[model samples]
Target: MRLMLLIRLIFLLLLNGVVLSYAHAASLAYEFSRVSNNSTEDLGRQLSMLVTEQSGGALFTFSNRLGVPSSITDIYFDDASQPLFSSIAYHSDSGAGVSFDSQAAPANLPGGNVIGFLAGFSGDSSAQSVEGGVATKGVMKNGVNSTDEWVSFLGLWANAGSFDGLIKAFADAHFRVGLHVQAIGLAGRSDSYVNQPSPVPLPAAAWLFASALFGFIVIANRRKV
Candidate 1:
């Protein structure tokens, strides 16, 4: 009887470990943001609308200034949304235009998901000279200025067997992904934002299977005793 109890304990430990491993294996996380106001609501609504339309899921705001240290606020999405890997755009203090860091996606993320990003431009008419683009080092166009920007967009690209394989693809190539919105400036301001990785809930079927497995293990132990 004692031996049977020990066996059951070991089985339970192993099962818990498997669930934890799967949780770590099936998800990815990243940071994203853009410039916007704190006093207004239009920009917030616009940004939320754009991200939802582009990503085909819900857009949860995070922060206004993730890349920019002096930024007022930056935004992030909920875990349910796939995230794109990249670096923050650097718009200089002197306004020599925007400079993007040499950014690359990590070689391995937990989930086998792909993502794309797009930004709409709107803001102070004077600061309108602020522009952005993807390049080796910096923003290419000066006329690309806008208050609102699409810092990152997420979408499923392709599936892989392992997390490491998915990461490798993100690191190596730029896959053409689609955006949900075409506009640049959101109407209002958002100060607070959400940035935590989304949790993957176990499906009901999986839960039932696990329960059955546990019951079988229990019965097996009883017979052995």
Candidate 2:
């Protein structure tokens, strides 16, 4: 009976540890999609996307379907008017065909493009990555060109002090962004509906509680034995 009690106690401790680990670690995560399917003309030949609240952690990977030389110029978290982050050259990933001359074929941005400058949480610049998916055609009538680009940034973590208030502000809030032509003019405008931050599962804690109760029962039984 004593051995059983000890075994039960150990199991409960281990289970609680797992819950704590998950709660502590931040996984940079986010899901995104185009804002609308309106024709390119109706949308003004611009690129825009909505970043939903299905995002967590500090590392953010932002991708845009804008044409070449068109890049993410600003990021607005929640309702603030001024951009939370901005940069002219966010730097493209290898999949963006960094070497390819856009003027030659007027190719679209690579779907696997990644912007590295947005990473703020993880000090490791290399943590940003690009997943090169198939290049989808852009909102052009020609339908011959592909306009997509991506970049990863160590978001929030690195700039927490400057963005401390915004960590939770984005949850249930909208993220509006602007894409600009490298030369001049606005390329596109897009926004996403960010859901409220989902709470961590309580099942882990519930299991821990039950385990503790079981341990108590085991101890009580051993005393009687």
lDDT of each: 0.30, 0.34
Model 2 Cα lDDT, one tens digit per residue, 10-103: 8867776776555433322333333333222222233332222223223344443444333332322322333344321222332532211111
Report each candidate's C-alpha RMSD, comma-separated, in the order given. 16.2, 12.6
If scored against the real structure, what TM-score would every candidate get?
Answer: 0.27, 0.32
For residues 86-201, write the lDDT of model 1, one tens digit per residue: 22222222234422221222211212232222221111112124334432222222211233332332333233212443333333422111111112235322233221122223
Q: Model 2, stretches more than 4 Å misplaced? A: 1-25, 39-57, 63-150, 156-167, 174-225
- Look at candidate 1 and tell me the lDDT of residue 128: 26
Best by TM-score: 2
Report how far off residue 85 is in candidate 2 (Å): 6.6
Instruction: Please report how far candidate 2 places residue 195 from its true position, in Å.
Output: 8.3
Model 2 global lDDT (CA atoms, 0 to 1):
0.34
